[model samples]
Every structure is written in structure tokens, then in C-alpha cells.
Target: MSTVVIAPELQKFLEVVRAELSDLDAEEQREITDGLVADLTDLIDDQGIEALGDPVAYAAELRQAAGLVSARKQVRERVAVGIRVHAVLDAAKARCRHVLEGLPGDVDELLTSLQPAWWVVRAYIAVQSVLLSSGGWSLSPVPDDSISGALALLVVVAASVQLGRGRLWPLTRWSGSALLRVVVLAINLIAIGLVPAVAGGFENREWDNYDAGYSDGMNEATGAYAVDDAGGTLFASGLPVGNIYPYDAAGNPLVGIQLFDQHGNPIQVKGKNECVYEGPEEVLTDTSRVFFPWSDGAAQRWNVFPLPSRIQGADVAEPDPTAFTGTNRPAVSGFPFVAVPKVSLPGLLTSAATTPPKAFVPGARTEDVNLVESGC
Candidate 1:
């Protein structure tokens, strides 16, 4: 018996199919793989190879045809889900290419067949070109109103003219049409490259937001440093409160040194005028903490000065920075007397005798101080 040599590509393809059908039991897998090797070993032609299409896709088809159960349901589910997702996307892509191909004749024919309707089609092509070249559609719903749009329109119109005159798509006797085509090609290439860039930008933005929150939380849990007015060190909450800025007389940003509170906590400064101060840990409630009727606002102190109007503020009481703690006290719900539990009323409401001021200190008066001036 003569030994039959299998093509390397065929071998590789067979291996991939085997790997994809890993869901089948070991015995079934062996049978399928052996049958595939035997059948493919006999044939070696582009037609035979092309007939298989993608190895992965072929494996899925074979599995379905054989009614073979997957060894791992999770793997099968993932693959099936991926196939479902790609089906619509791939179909849409094919549809777009078909549409582009269906458009009227090449440059030379387009010039000769220039009709009122053809011009409208040309305009649509121009708009689409601008949109693709600029990547405006990727970033926003509306097209960017810029020079890129103008350039895209210009290139498409020129290409259309060349195509109308019965010449090549981009080259009209090596004239402006050729240059315009190059530009259009460049724009398309750049836009395609920018797909990853735009995606990366979004990813980076999300990461930055997450990192900032994490850092703020960590800082709040730990303590921060600052200096007092008398230049003494003091312990303070690690949480950032606000910023401060100091500049030279010439208005240049001064760096190198950081400011501290009277407590000796080191103040963090970024750029020239920007400063970050430490404060209390933040508080969050599952429900809105606001009682609109009684509270003019909630967490009003969170509003940093010299900035835009803040909608909400920080915690009213300083939070325990070391760890997250829950209160045993039942949350006070609803408004005033209606929501208050009658059993807890006495404990909830402070006694009037203890609540009122012992001595009503009216307005400030010089007579109260009884200051005497030295005879001058």
C-alpha cells in the first residue's frame, strides 16, 4: 500500500475543525476527525478547499448536521451567540457593497450620462464621501461642519466628473481627478484607522472616570496631610474638599511647594491656580435624601466656590473614613409628622426644655463687653 501525503493547508484546516467541535465527546470527536482526514486526504484542489469555506463555520455546520451535542454547553452557547451577532452585521456589510456596485457606470460614462437626477445622486455620493472621510458619523449623529466636509464634497464631485467622461475612477488623463481620488482614498484610510482610535478613546475615558472615583474613595478611607495657620501638623480626612490657587505678581503659576491647612495637612495643587484640600468622607443613600419642604437643599457644603452652580452638596456630617458603616437607626421616611412612628416619637423629637437656649443672646452689643478706653 502506497502512503498518501496530505497538503499542509488541508492538515491545518482539519485541525481547526477538530478544535472547533471540541464540544463532542472524545469518541465522537475521534470519529469525526478521522472521517474528515480520510475524505480530505484524497482531494487537493482550490475548489475542494473553497467548498469548505471557513473551518470554524464548517465545523458548526457539521455539528448541526450530525446532531452532535457539545461537550461544554458554555462554549457552545458563546459560539452560537457570536454567530447570531455577526449574521446581521455581515449581511448589512454585504448589502452596502452591493449598493455601491449598483450605482451607474464609470467616470467616462457618468460625464456623458449627466442628467438632473444623476446630479442629485452625485450630491448624495458627495455627502456620504464627506461623512466617511471625516469620520463624523462615528463620533456624532450630525456631520462635522468643517474643511474636511468641503474637501470630501470636492473630491467626490471631481471623481463623478471623471467617471462621467468615460475615464478611470480616479484618473482623468492624470489631471485633478487623480489627485482628488488620492485625497478621497487617504481620507477613507484614515477613517478606517481611526475606528480603533475612537474605540480606544472611549475606553480611556471610562478608565479615567473609574480611576478617579477609586482614588477619591481610597483617599477618603485613608487620612490626608495639611498645615495649620500657625504652621502646625494636624490630622484630617483624606477625602478631597476643594482647590486653591496662588500666583506671582506677574500672573505666572508658581510650582514646587504645596500649601497646607492650619492643621498641617499637605495641600495638593495641580497647575498654577488649582489646589485640592482634604475633607470628610462622602455619603450615599439608596433613595434621594432630600426633603424638599423642610430642607432648602441637601449636602449643600459639597458645592466648591468660584465654580459653576452645584445641584447638590456633600455629606452634612463627616463620615468615618476607615471603613464603610451602616446605621442601626431606621431611616426616617416621608415628611414631618405623617411618616414619623408614634412609638419612636419621644426619642426622635428632642425635648423642648433641652432644645431651647438657656440664655437668649440677642444681637452683639458693645455694652455687653464693657470695654474702657485709656484716657489719652
Candidate 2:
């Protein structure tokens, strides 16, 4: 005959009772819970889990039957919650176990083996709670940049593992004092409840960094990075280069530059680029500024670099459909940079004679090439 082991659910049920009776002496508590594991397993198998009912109520009845319920024990530090709340929880727990027990596999041992993993998770939740309270939590599971952070994390997790294994101080004995046990259980419950909120904080922080990492470099000290959402426009790094600016090797800002792709197709930017111009006002003493986009006349050439802007009171028409007659604000070219440091262009790559690149025919298919006649 196979030896019977106590189910994990039953063990959890007994743990709750043990916690409730934390005020009692170890010897008496042991007398109550000791050999009942096998007995209750048989009992539950015989009459279904309903036979055991609520573990809290059963503990109370057992204490009363054994004459262990003293007046002082009745009102003891059970301030955690009353019997009814515990009974409801016990019933819910039993229902969950019933559902799991019905599943067609060895779920009992599967859960039993996974208990250590929960220890690590609970420890992380505890550490995150502390960091969150300080209002500086980071997205990384281990957020410290130095060795101290790693050491602190190790200490916390090791303590938690020890606590879970019942190898720590008071629990190393039969149990700790009632007040200490109650406080520990309350802390664990708080950690469990904080999982969703902690996860949300990390997710929000991740997206914030992603969005800010790609915006205009004016707000950030760092240069702009290219983003994937530039809509077929010119991008430097990852940011959309709204208008192109070029510099000669001597660092002088060059104008009227045009760009093309590897296929010799003109590279055009699809989005609008608004340019601001400042000029002396005629009627007022203060200078004025105008917001208008300059273009290469009616042709609307976007591939041209350093597109110019018009001044406040120039002869150019107000930015509208008719404003594209000719490039306006010719004298006031509003290039973002006057000069930029030059960079060396890389040398052109040459293909190996043995492994030439594949020839690309614009619109020709394999069948079209096959049907073509060679030189006569």
C-alpha cells in the first residue's frame, strides 16, 4: 500500500488554524494537529471536503471540546479579523481546492513543488513595495546600479526564503507569539495585493522613457533619435528631420542641397515643416514673427535641403494655397544651424569578382527574363 501524504490544500487549511491558535502552548497545539493529517485525509476522502467544513470553526469546536478555550483565549489578540470572515475565506479556499482537485492530473504535487517559486515572487513584491514607498522605483527587477543594490536584494530574498522555510527565529520554534504571527501574515497579504499596482507602475515608466527618448532634441540635452513613425520622411538617427540641413567639410552650412536614394530616386519628406521668421515691424517699435512654411515655389521640392523662411512683414503672401507662387522670404533663410562639424564619408564598397551582387531589373519577373532573346 502507498503511504498517503497530506494534500497541499489541507496543509494550508491546517496552517490557518495553527496561526489562529498561536496564543496557545506548543505542546497542546501539537496534540491537536499532530496525527490528524492522515486521519483528515481519510475523512475528506470518505465524506467529501464538506465533512471538514471551515477550518477556523473546526479549530474553535475542537478547542471547546478539549476544554482549551479559556475566557482570556477567546478575546485574545485575534484582532486580525473575526471568525466569520475567516470562515468565508476558508470556504472560498476550499472551493478553489475542489476545482483544482477535479482537474485530471497530478496538480497536488505540482503545486507543492512550485511553493519555493512563490517565495521569490513574494520577496520581489516586498522589495518593490519598499522602493515604491520611496517614490523612486525603476523598471528593472533588480534596479540598483551598484553592488550594494545587488547585495541588498540578496539579503531580502534570502530572508524571505528563510521565512518561507520556517527556519527563521520565532517560527523555528513550534510557532511565534500571536502578535508577531498576525503582523507577518498581514504583511504577506499586503504584498499579494500590491502585485497589480507594481506591475502597472513599471509598464507606465517603460512607455514614458520610450516616448521621450525620440522627441525633438531641444527639450532633451541628447540628440534626436530616429523613430519608426516618420511616414516616409527623412530621419536622422530616429527622429524625423523636418527639414534637411547640410554642412561642408569646413563646417559651413551649405544650402540648395538635394538628396537621392540608393536607386537614384529623389528622397522626399512627406510631412510639413513650419519655419518662423523675425523682422522689424513697420507700425510698432517691437519686432514681429511670422509662422509660414517655405517651399521651392509651385514645384514644392522637398528633397532640396535648407528650405528658407519669410520674415514678419515681407512681400510674400500669407501662408495659403496661393503662397507657393515662388519661394518667399528669400533674404531671411531660417536654417536651424549656421554651421556643423564635418564628418568623413565612408569609401564606396566594391563587390568581389567571384561573388557579384544580384542584378536588379526594375519590373522584370523570372519568366520575363527567361523569354528575352540574347544577342544574335
Candidate 3:
């Protein structure tokens, strides 16, 4: 039987434990090291590398279990400090909100300006929830560019509304009523101005650089080849069809070929415009392209094309004389030709030249195509 090796990080942790335990009774240290090794090995065998959350944490836990007082105290102090910091931030936020409630004029605008401050508190609460909810602590979720842009837009709006109201309130109380209206209108316009820019920012952050790769398809007649769910593998004759080539609409050899599935679906195959006698040397190189069932996102779908194949004993220029015609010529004059000789071959091979696989023929009704989520 083969032995599975422990990861280097785990091995180093064991070494550190061994060093720390050296001050103990010789036999006791050996026994502790052996037990720790056995426990770690079992953990690796069962749960894999995920058994260790963090190397330092793992080491600290092991030290505590082995009765190392100093290490245990250090870990406890770190945890206590973190808890206290979170508590202080939470109290500060509560105080700020209470103060906001007593202030006058457009509470919504004031709240909007104070959102950033509230988020700090909200993030702290979220972390606390994670800690108390049996999952332990987790960091605040990273805001995407879209979220950041939205927040920025909100801030601008809040500032504009506050400034406009402050400027117009005094003017409206005086004789300059028209000037006050103009200020109010200007504030609204400036707030509206953020809409298009916010929309553009949303588009840029979400979709600007995204390029969904090709779709997959398969030969209708021959169901011998297909791609994986992610279209990374090319199965030919129940195996990977190693040779892949892309062609343009004019049938010229291009860089990458679009492959199809058994259901005549086109799949995407990524490649550069370079010719190699060998087949696809890289399969599933990018994590984004890999087909993980858990993450069935849009990027997983592929578009594939058919690669070139060799015709046995046939020259490129000549027609395949082996093709069965309806009428066979008699060997001699007046000799009867075999009547309707059976051709023991695969599906009907039409005399028509090879071409790209047919595109998907969508059903007449939108429901048939399963456009709605209810149908799917």
C-alpha cells in the first residue's frame, strides 16, 4: 500500500510542537508528538487539507491541548481584544443614531450622509452574527465596484440635497422666492445627473470586460463525440477527440474550433490562432472554464466546432468510389448485377461535402425554448 504524505505546513506545525514539548518529560514529549501526528494524519485522511483552518491557529490549538500555558493565554488575549473592539464600535453607532433622531429637517438626507458610518457598525454586527451563529467569525463581504459606485452616488445625492435645502431655506423665508425655487431645481437636476453616470458605472463594473466564450454542439448523424458540461473535454469514439481546429465562415483553418454536444448543441473551445500537428495540449487550464456543478454560471457554457478528420485511402481531390450507388454496373455484358446490395456501414453518408454543424433550431413557442424560469 502507498503512504500519503502530510502537507509541508502540517509537518512544520508538528516540528514546532515537538520543539515546544522538549522541555517536558522525554517520554511525555514523545507520546504527545506521536499522538498529535496520528490525529493530524487522520484529519488529513478524512477531511483533507481543510482540517487546518490556519497554520498559526492550528499550532496554538495544539499547544493548548498539550498544556502550553503561554501560547493558550496569548490566543485568549487576542480573542478578547477583538471582542472588546467590536463592542466599542457597536456602542458608538448606537449613540450616533440616537443623536441623529433629535436633529431636524430631512432625516432621510441626514441618514444617507451617515450611511458610511452605519456600514462600519453593520459590518461589525455581521461579523458578530457569523461568530455567534456556529460558523465562527467571518470578515465583512467585499463590496463589488457596482456597490461602491452606488454608495458614491448616494453620497453625492445626499450632499446635494442637504446643501440645496440649507441655501434655499433662508432665501424662501426672504423676498428671493424665485431664487429659492431655482436652487431647489438645481439640486434636483444635479441629483438626476448622477443617474446616467451611476448606470454607466453599473454597466462597466458588471459587464464591460466580460466575454462569454463559445457554445458547444455535436454531429447529428454521428453521436460518437461530445464535450463535458463545461465543454473542456472532447469525447471522440467515447474518448477525448484530441485534434481540434477552428474554421472561419469561409471554411479556412482558424485558431480554435467550436465543438457540439450529442444533442447538436454548439460548445465553446478556447484556443489561439496557431497550428499544431498535435491536439489540444491544454485542457481545463483556467479555473473559470472548469465545469464545477456547484457553480453553474454563464461562463460554464461552451461553443465547440468540428475538427478535421482523415478519410481512409482517399485522396483529397477524388470522390469516394466506395460509396454505394442505387445501380451497380454489371461485371460483363448481359450479366445480372446484384440486386440492392446491402451496405453494412454507419448512417447514410450523403455525397454532399463536409460542412460546419447545423445551428440549433429553436422551437416555435418561447415556452418551448424554456425562456421562463417556471418552465426550466
How close is every model to the real structure, measured as TM-score? 0.20, 0.35, 0.19
**Least accurate stretch of 10 residues (summed lDDT) in model 2?**
367-376
Q: How would you encode candidate 3's per-residue C-alpha lDDT over 19-56 as one tens digit per residue?
A: 65555667755655666667888888799867756655
Count of clashing residue pairs in every prediction: 29, 6, 33
Best by lDDT: 2
Compared with the true structure, the alpha-carbon lDDT of candidate 1 equals 0.44
lDDT of 2 by residue, 1-376 (tens): 9976777788888888777677679898887778778778898899877787788887887677767864455465363444555565568768978888999997867887997887878887777667777876455656444667667777888888888777866567744444445556676788889998789768867876776655655334443444344455554544555555555665555555677889987666553423232222222212122323335656666566654433333232233444337564333244445456755567844322221112111121111011001110
TM-score of 3: 0.19
**What do the candidate models score in CA lDDT, each in turn?**
0.44, 0.59, 0.42
> Whole-model lDDT, candidate 3?
0.42
Q: lDDT of candidate 2?
A: 0.59
Residues 261-316, candidate 1: write the lDDT tens digits: 58865443211111112223322221111111111246322112111111112332
In model 2, which runs have C-alpha deviations exceeding 4 angstroms?
1-95, 171-185, 215-376
Off by over 4 Å in 1: 1-176, 224-376
Poorly placed runs, candidate 3 (over 4 Å): 1-147, 167-177, 183-304, 309-376
Candidate 1: C-alpha RMSD after superposition:
24.3
